[model samples]
Target chain A: MLAKNKKSLIIFIILSLIGAAIYLFTLSDSFMYQRDIGKITHVSEGSSQRTEDEFKNVDHQHEQKITMIMLNGKQKGKKIHTHNSWSNSGAFDQKFHSGQQVFVDLQKQNGRTTAEISDYKRDTYLLMLGWVVISLLILTMEFKGLKTLFSVVLNFVVFLLFIELDVKLNLTNFFWLFVLSAFIFTALSLLIVIGWNKQCAVTFASIVIGTTGALMIGVLVLNYTGNDLHYEALDFATQSPKQLFLSATVIGLLGAVMDAATDIVSTVFEIKRSHPQIDQKQLFGSGIEVGRAILGPLINVLLLIFFAETFAMGVLFFRTGNSIGYTFEWTMSLGIVQSLISGIGITLVIPAASAFAAWAFRKEGQVENN
Target chain B: MKTISILTVILAFLMVLVGGKQGFSAFFSVLINFLLLFLNIMLISSGFPPLWTSLFSGICILAITIYMGNSDEKSSNVAFLATLAVMVVMLLLIVPLDHLVQVKGFANEQSEEIEAFNLLVGVDFEKIAISTTILSTLGAIAEAAIAIASGLNEVIEQDPQITPLKLRKSGQNIGSQIMGMTFNTLFFGMFGGDLALFILLNKLHNSFGYYLNSKIFVSECMLVLYSAIAVILVIIVTTWLMSRKVRPQRSA
Candidate 1:
């Protein structure tokens, strides 16, 4: 126990120190950027301006008096005062305040220095949130939580590499590339969670099988029926909308599919371990039972996630007087489509999970019988 | 439109075909959930406080998801309470973190799509951000809570005389696996959902430091982290509650 305490204390101190270092790094990292960065040390409201949008509603807008100290560039440590307008909705304009670091556009006229806030220097806060999460994981889970965090970070690296690869390849055959990525993601995540065991292999095989099975059916149906997907409402996606959506669908299915497959496999294995004499038939039956229980929660999880993604835009569409159908068409149609595909994956994974799990245990059961 | 209808039908049929009644209920729960989210959006747009509206919606989702997905009264109840506790903890964590992170409203990437629409929606973008954070993580928290509670319930049922130590170990065992799987789910969900945006950022040649600080990237990262944090908290809360409920306390 003393040794365990010392180990975690060391880990805890290291994580905290890392967090502090990142926080300071974000403050100093501004020098590499061409744009001048500043933190608003004082802010005062200037005025409120009312304007009309395309919807013809009177919008309230305001401005602030900002006194900022430049964090980097030739004007480092120099104080600049400027103000910018903001709207209540902040749809396009932004609201800035004291202690918030921002990217600034600096101007010097007649030896007078002035700056305008361009963007927020938010890396510090992001790192803060990341550290909070890692700290909690460490405090609660100790070394195992560290492993989980490491695995997640590893998956993130792999994902970034996948993205980089897709980009370096210039988006050719993107969907197939993502399908390959799905395999890697599933295998890596399962290997980390379950380690290299019979159970891990079974879970991985079932996830791949289930995901691909669903994709084939989904793709075939989309092709046979002709694509009716709307690409107009896509945000900042300058690629082939269909390809983006398809890739998104494939990756989305990975998480939920892994979730369902793991649950089914773990439950099946647990039942087998606790009851050695349990036949493969009963074990498979029990796996299906576990699948049924998780069915609703699984779909609900996907729906909530997808809806939240599009929820803000959907609301803005409605607030602007767009009908529900149009809003649904514009903001939510693709998300729903993605969810349906994932739903199919979740649905198919159940049988794949039970079948693979029971089969993986069959030889073990036969040996026991002998 | 035609594709959505056909696919919906096929999904419904398959869900029923595999999950049977559970699938049917799952189908309803999903339908109700969509409607609830729709209502949430509507209320916030109509000038309801975004934070309050989303809180109400999160509570409803938690209740409906727990009761509908679970048939056992005890496990569902315990899960509900544990999930609510986690939600409160999440809300506390989110409000301050959101303020510091400053990732509210439409992102810079969204400027083109939303520029011409409107500016005066009479809503708090910051509060909407908070609302979104809360509601998004509700599913994972509730799901983990139900899994742990029900799993522990079964363990106790199997051996009614099990000590608190054994029950605690089992809960940890169950919680740890679920935690790992849930992390995978949230991480992939974030990656898959944001792949398009990442590609966009890469094309823009936004440096890694710039992307890390951007509203789009930070917001997505925070969403995943929030869900993950909530799920981990759920495991702890559910495990502790289960052990306590199952164990009889002696006077100290």
Candidate 2:
């Protein structure tokens, strides 16, 4: 264990060094629009103040002069002065303290350069947290942990590559891409994590069937209920809203379905392995029983995830005096529907996975008995 | 919303029909869980502290979920203790990460949506973000905790004389399997939730670096990572707790 920990620590340090090196080089020049990193050196007392009506109370805002040192770009090591507006609510306002890192946005007009503080530089913090997660995983599960991390990275790469290909091919039917990506993701992840095995095959089948069933049900329900898919809530859609909504549903249901499939398949496989004399019927029954035990909490997991994501918006709506009905309609209706659909998918996967396992593992169980 | 509610009603009825008493209990658990969440939101909006409200609702949801999901008191007790222990550890880890990340409030792009409302609603968005992170991860943590606890409990019951070393190994095996799927669940869930936003960035032609630096993107990434961490912690902690509790008896 000590040797393993030492090796992991070495790897961690090397990875961090590589990350820092990349960050340093990127700071000097990047393909994207340039922004300078700066450290706040000083902050002045309030230079101006304003008051506004906030809900049922009054809110005060103050403007302060901030001095920062440019850490990168052409203006490296230069001291720049900027103005920051701090508000009590901290909604759109950010308060800068001395020694805080910030992104300095530079604009040139009339041959003069003006620097303003755009936002806090959050990369370092994110990197720190990422390292924490990776280290914890490596220390705990060792080789399997490494494999899991590799698969996660590959999943993201595959997703990005799909998007790139879709853009290049000018694919108009995004729903197809969504479905294809979901399948590819499921296959790649299952194959990598579980390797080429019957369990992987069974779980993969269960996920695809479960997700498809849920998608069909979602479509049917949406059509019958006359609930207009709220495309407007998807604030960033530049493509067909219908396609986007459908894609979201398909992608969202993938994880829960995969989770259910894994749970059911693994439990049944274990049971069959230990109790080889058990018949297929009994194995299927046990699979269903295990699924029942887990189904409620699993559904709640998805529900809470979907609902809590909308909590901020929900609170904002209600605080603004919007009626609860209006708030629910505007802020949470989409998430609610999405969660329900995923929940249905998760629920359906139990039987799908149990049946698949029953069929796939039937021969092996009987072989041992014979 | 109305149609979805009606569909939910139908789902509840069908579950009871198909699953019998367990299904009905599950349905009730979901219903009460939703109500508790609603109550939490109401409390947060009514000037209660966001952190406390989140904690309160989290406990209530865990209690109700474990109670309804498990029939016996022993299982429920084990689930609750394991889940709560994991939650406390996650909360401790999150508080510092939240401070370091310092991601608060709506994204800059969301300003257009909130133009009509007062920007300064006197709510501390920083606190809101913390609570949101905690609440979002609570359900998954609880689910994983209960799953591991009950699974090991069954293993122990089957082999009352099994050595602790062997039981621990079984616990690790179960944890590994649970972790594999839960990680996927979390990853895809976040992916699906943010698909539109990704499309938005693509259409706007934002560079990869810029996308990485953007507040919304960073926030979402943090959320995904936080949940993953929580799930990992729950698996390890739940396994350890269960193994310790179900140690082999000497005279069995």
TM values, all candidates: 0.93, 0.92
Docking class of 1: medium
Task: Put down candidate 1 lDDT per residue, B81-109, tens digits, no spaces.
Answer: 99999999888989998877777788878
Tens-digit lDDT track for model 2 on B230-249? 88887887777766665535
Residue by residue across A219-311, what tens digits does model 1's lDDT show?
888898785778656666867878888888888878989988988887777656656777888878877876776777777787888888876
Q: Model 2, residue B223: what's the lDDT?
A: 86
* CAPRI-style grade of the A/B interface in model 2: medium
User: Which regions of candidate 1 fall more than 4 Å away from where they truly are?
Assistant: A1-34, A52-58, A107-114, A363-370, B157-161, B248-252
Give Cα distance to truth, residue B138, candidate 2, Å: 0.8
The collision pairs in model 2 are none
Model 1 chain A poorest 10 in a row by lDDT = A361-370
